[model samples]
Target: MSDAQYTLPKTNSGPWNTRPFHRQWLMRQANNLFDFFEAASLNPKGGFFELDDAGKPLDGANSTRQIHGTTRMVHCAAIGSLIGRPGSGEILDHGMQYIWNQHRDTRRGGYVWSLDNGGVKDGSKQAYGHAFVLLAASSAKLVGHPLADQMLADVTEVINTRFWDASRGAVKDEYTSDWSKLLPYRGQNANMHMTEALMAAFEATGNKDYLTKAEAIAKLIIAEHAASLGYRVAEHFDENWVLDKNYLGNEMFRPAGTTPGHWLEWARLLIQLWVLGEKRLHWLTDAARHLFRAAIDLGWDKVHGGFFYTLDWDNKPVMREKLWWPLAEGIGAASFLTSYDRDDYFQIWYRKLWDFADNHMIDHARGGWLSELKEDLTPTSRLFVGKPDIYHALQACLIPLYPANGSLTKGIIEADHTAKIAH
Candidate 1:
C-alpha cells in the first residue's frame, strides 16, 4: 500500500461522535473514577492498598504490591490533577514517593517487581513494571510533582541501560534485582506499554529521542510482528523475539495464545505514536486500523457485547471470560478512530463499546468498574479479587475528551491553554 493510501478520509460524524452531551459524560466518568480510587487506594506505610470487591482495603503483608499498581495509581492521580481535581496532587506525590522509597532497588539498580511490608516481595525486575515506572514518572513530571524530575531521570537511565535491546529495536523482558541472570524470554506486552510510556515521556519532556525509540518499538511489534501474523498480536516470544506458540508461562499475565485486548491497546498506541511522529509514518495508522478490526473479529464475543480475555492459535477463545481492561482498550481504540477518521464505523463502535462497559462491567453502585465478567456478560471474580485498578477504565473515559495525537497529560494542558485563549 502506498503511504498516501493511509490518508483515511474523514466524514460527518453522528451524535456519538459530535454530541456535546458525550463530552460531559466522559468527564463525569473520569471524575467518578478519580473519586473512587483516590478515596480508597492509599496505604499509609508506602504504596497503595489492595482493595476488595467493595472498595475496602484488603489485607496487605499477606500479598504483594506489584509495580504496575503503584505506578498506575500515580498516573491516574496525575491525570486527575491535570483535570483540576482537588487533592489529586497528594495522591500523585504520595505514589511517586512510595515508588522511589519502596519499589526502587537501592541495593542494585532497577526497580523491583513487587514489594511487601518489610521490603522486596518479588525482587525480579520486569520490563512491564519498569515501563509503568517511566509512564508514572512522566505523568508526575507533567503535573509538576516534586519528586518527578529525579524519578523520571532514574527510571530513564534504568530502562535505557537495562531493558532496551538496541539491536532488535525493542526492550528485553526480565532480570533479577542484582542485574544478573537475564531472562531469555521476550514479549510484546511490556514493549507495547513501553511505546505508551515513551510517548508520555515525549509529551512531558519534548524529547524526540523518546519518540525515536517509540517508533522503533511500534514498528517492530505492530508494523512487523503483528502485521506478519494477521495483526493478531502474539503475546510471547523467545529471546531472539521469535514467537513461542506453546508458551503459557502464567494464566493471568502470559496466558496461552493471543490476547485480543493487547491488539486494541496496540491499535491506540500505534495511532498515538503516529500522531506524535507528525504522521510521517503512514503504515502506523493502517496497522492500527487492522489491529482494531482484528480485535473485534477475533476477540469480541458475538453472543455477548464484551471482549474475550484470550484466544487460542485456532482463533477460538482460550480464556472466554470478558475483561474490563479490554473494554477499556476497545473504547480507547474506537474513540481514537472516531477522532482520527471521523467515520461512523469507528464512532458506532465507540458508543457500542462504552455502552457495553456501562451495562455490564461498570458497577454503578460499587464505585469502580468490575474487573471480570462471564462469557455471558455477568459479573465474575474467577480471575480477579476486587476492584483492582482504575487506569484503563479511567483512560477509556478521558482519551476521547482530548486530542488523538497526545497523552492525557498533553491533552489536559492543551485544553487548558485553549480555554485560557477563549476566555
Candidate 2:
C-alpha cells in the first residue's frame, strides 16, 4: 500500500496502532544519548561524584547542600539497563562502596539519604532513597554485577528495619536518622515508585518474595487510594493515611487536580505486571482499565493536543501545562492499551501525543527534548528539558517497539486531519 493509504490492524478491545520504523531508531538513539548522563557521575574511588551547576564535585568539604547518593546510583543502573552497558554495574559498585564507607548507619542498619555535597551522611533515611537503591541493585544484576545479589538482600534489610509497616500493610514514607518513623507523612508517589522498584527486584532475582511485596503494595493502592472517578494519589499523608490537603496548591498546573505522571506510571507498571503472568491479573486488569479511563477522561487536554500536568479529583483540568514525562507515559499507556484491545480513540490519542511532543517538547532549534510546554504548545520552561534526563529519553525511545495495529494507525492519520481542521 502507498504511504498515504497505509493503515494498521485493529483488536476487538482496548487500543491499537501501527508501529513505525522510526520508533526503533528513536529508542536506540535515546539509549545512546542518555548514556552520557550516567557516565558523567563516575569517580575513580568506586564512588560516583555528585556534580553541581558548574559540573564541579560537591563533597561535604566543598558544599553545604547534600546529595542523595542513591539517586546517582539508580540513574546509573537504569541507564545501564537501557544501553546494555557495564558502566551501570560500576556505578552501583561505586555507590555501594560509598554507602559502606561513609553513609551507612551501623546502629540503624540503613543508609542515610543525604550527605553534604562532600559525602557525609547527615540526613534522614527516606523511603524514596531506599527505593532507588533497590531499583539500582536490581538493575545492576541485569548488567552482570556480582554484588547485586547482596544489594538485593540489603534492600530487604533496609525495608524491614526502617520502612516496612506490617500493620498498615504498606511501607512508611520516611524515618529519622535513628530509624524512628517520621509521623504525619506517607505518600502515594513513594508507594508507586516502591512498587516499581520491587517489580524490578523481582525481575532480577526471580524471587517470589519481591513479587509478593509488589502485589501487596498494588492491593493497598487499590484499596486505599484507587477511587471510582480517578485514582487519587496525594503528595503527602499523615501516618494514619489521612491526606494533607494543605499541600494542594493551585500554583502549578495540576490536571484533574492530581499528578498525571504518577497515574500514568502506575498504569504502565500494572500493564507490565499483568503481562508478566503474575497472580493478580484481575487487579492488574482493573487498574489498567480504571487508570486509562480516568487519565483520558481527566488528564487529557481536550482543547489542546497533549495531556495537562494535573487535574482535580472530579476529573476537571487543574494544571493546563504539558510535561515531557507525561508524554512518555501517555505513549506507554497508549501502546499497551492498543496491544490489549484496538480502538480508534486510543490510536488518535497516541498520535495527538506524538504530534504535540514533536511540535512542542522537542528542541528542533537547539538539541534534546524540552521538559515542559505551555498549553498553546510553546516552551514554558527549559530547566529540566534542556538538561537531558536519561529516563525521559529511554521512555521516548520505546515508541517503535510497540506492535503496529492497522486500525490504530488509521485512527492516528484521521486524528491528524482533525487537528489540522481545528487549527
Candidate 3:
C-alpha cells in the first residue's frame, strides 16, 4: 500500500483540531467514490449494475435491476451533481429514467422489487424499495430533474395509500403486486428507510406531512419500540407493531435479532429530525445519543475491531460476520454527534471508525469499499458481493463534512453554492 493510502487520521494532528483536515480528506474520498461508482456501475439502458471484485458485472445482461440499488444510485448521483462534479447529471438522468420506465409498476401502482432481462424478477411490492423510490425522487427534485416532482407525488400517494398504517404510525413491510393483500409481517427496516425517505421528501417539497410522518416513525422506533427493548431496535414486528425478535423474514434484509447498524442509523436519522424540528424536540437528541451508545456497547466486538452483523436478544453476536454498512453508520452517527455537541467521545469514535474502514473495508486495488468481512477482517462475501451501492459509504464520507443541522441535501446545496461563490 502507498504511504498515503492506509495512514490513520490523528485526533491531535494540529493544535486546534484536525476536523477541518478530516473534512477535506472526506470530500476527496467521497468525490473519488462518486466518480468510481458512476463509471463502473451504470448499465447502458439505464440504472446500475452490481459488480464483482474485479469490477465486472455480476449478472451480465440478465442482471437484476433492484429498485433499492437504482434509487440509491440516483441519490448519490444527485449529491454529486449538486456538488459540481462533472458527468453526474448523466447518471442522475439515467437512474431517473430507469426508475420511471422499468421499476415502476405502471398498472399496479408501486415499484417492483427487482427487474431482470426477462422483466419483473420479483414483482412483490416491498415498502423498503418504495421508500428508496421516494428518497430518489426527492433528491432528483432537489437537483432539478424534469420529472422528479411528479415522481415524488406518485410515490407519496402509493406509500400513503398502500404501505402506511394510519393507526400505528408505521409503514407496513410488504404487499402483493396487485395490492390486494398485505403481507404477514411488519418491519422496522422498512420503517427506518421510510423515515429517511420522508425526511428527504420534506426537504424537497416543504411538505409538513412528510416531516410529521417522519417524526412519528422516529418516535415509534426510537422512543417506543427501542425503549421497550432497552434501545436495541427490533427489526421485525407483527401487524399490530409488536416486536418479533425471533422472526427471520428475510436472510439479507430482515434477519432475526437486532441489528446494531440499524440502531446507529436511527441515531443519525434522529439527529436529523432533531435538527429540522427546530431543536424543539429535546427528546430526539437524547434518544439519538442513547441509541449511539447502545449500539457501541452492545454491538462492537472487542476481540474484533468491527461491529457484528447481528446480535441476539441477549446481546450475543448472532452472525459474526462484519458488514460495511454498520461502520458507515457509525461514522455518520459519531460525526453528527460530534458536530452538534463537540463531544470528544464522538470525535474519538469517528476517528477510530475511519481508521477501521481505511485498514479493512476500502478496496485499495479497485476503488470502492469491500462490502463484507470476516471477524478477523479478511474479505468475505458471505452476504454481499463487491460493492452493491455507494449510498451508505458515500454518505459516511460526505455527511461528516457538512453541518449536522439540516438534511444532507440541504447541506450539499449550501456547499455547492458556497463553492460557486468561492470560484
Question: After superposing candidate 1, which stretches have Cα over 4 Å from the reference?
Answer: 1-17, 60-63
Q: Give lDDT tens digits, candidate 2, residues 214-257.
A: 67777777545675335655555678877665555324322124
lDDT of 1 at 73: 93
**Per-residue lDDT tens digits of candidate 1, residues 290-388?**
999899877888887688899888899988899889899999998887777744567667767888888888888978899999888778889887988
Local distance difference test scores for all models = 0.86, 0.60, 0.85
Highest TM-score: which candidate?
Answer: 1
Q: Which candidate tops lDDT?
A: 1
RMSD of each predicted structure: 3.7, 9.0, 4.0
Per TM-score, what order, best first? 1, 3, 2
Q: Candidate 2 regions off by >4 Å?
A: 1-20, 40-103, 248-257, 277-280, 314-319, 364-366, 382-388, 399-423
TM-score of every model versus the real structure: 0.95, 0.76, 0.94
Global fold similarity of model 3 (TM-score): 0.94
Ranking by lDDT: 1, 3, 2
Instruction: Count the clashes in each prediction.
Output: 0, 36, 0
